[model samples]
Target: MRGGNQMSQLMKQAQKMQEDLAAAQEEVALMKAEATAGGGMVRLVMGAGHQVETLEINPDVVDPQDLEMLQDLLTAAFNDAASQLDQMTQERMAEVAGGGLGLPGF
Candidate 1:
């Protein structure tokens, strides 16, 4: 009987953890991060899931004479946003995994 009671308690704890993880995932989905480059001539927005949501380019940055520079700015903005998104994901997943355990698929 005592063993049965312990098992039941453990099962309950596992279920609660599962619920907490699900809630955390939902919160992450609703979060976003932004990055900018080229003195704010370009901006990138990334979701918590590491997906690019938006890109903004300043009209003043438009210059046929300097298209390569504009392209570089866009790339920098995107890479910055992606780096931030990776960091956010790691932090959140660590919080979810209860200290990151370096779990698989986390």
Candidate 2:
């Protein structure tokens, strides 16, 4: 029953891969990425799971009359940080998903 044995081995491999993927996801969630906007006036850090860890704004960019401008900078900074988080997650997951599985674009 060589074929049966091979199937069992394959099942084991798949189970191991699933475990690895779960671990990788947890790692990625803890990973952080950062971004800045408005010439570094707005900065933010985001986790790979899309949670904002921190945000900082330079006082010089905070105009009392320019609420819209301040809002725009904040939005841009958050979006950039989120994009970075996405990239970080993809790269980290790929390390686990591409472990000799011959999977396409893991």
Candidate 3:
């Protein structure tokens, strides 16, 4: 009877943890991370779900003669935003899971 009660309690705790994780994931999906490059001439906003929410380019950075430079700046801004979003999601998940998920190979 004691062992059964302990197992039941553990199952309940696991279910609660799973619920918390799902809620945290939903919150993170709605969060946004922003990054800029070329002195803020290019900006990108990314969601935790790895989706680009918005992108802005300053008129001053648009040069028909140097499209390559503009492309490079855009790439840099996108990479920065994606990286930020990844870190934010990971940190949030860790917090939700109480430090770590404890899964093998993470």
Model 3: residues with Cα > 4 Å off, grouped in runs: 99-106
Model 2 lDDT tens row, 10-53: 78878888999989878886888889998999999887567888
- Give the alpha-carbon lDDT of every model: 0.80, 0.85, 0.85
Whole-model alpha-carbon lDDT for candidate 1:
0.80
RMSD of 2: 2.6
Q: For residues 4-96, what per-residue lDDT tens digits would candidate 3 score against the true structure?
A: 987887777778888899998898879888999999999898886678888999999999999999999989988888888888888888887
**How far does residue 31 in candidate 3 sit from its true spot (Å)?**
1.6
After TM-score superposition, the amount by which residue 73's alpha carbon in candidate 2 deviates from its true location, in angstroms, is 1.0
Clashing pairs counted in every model: 0, 0, 0
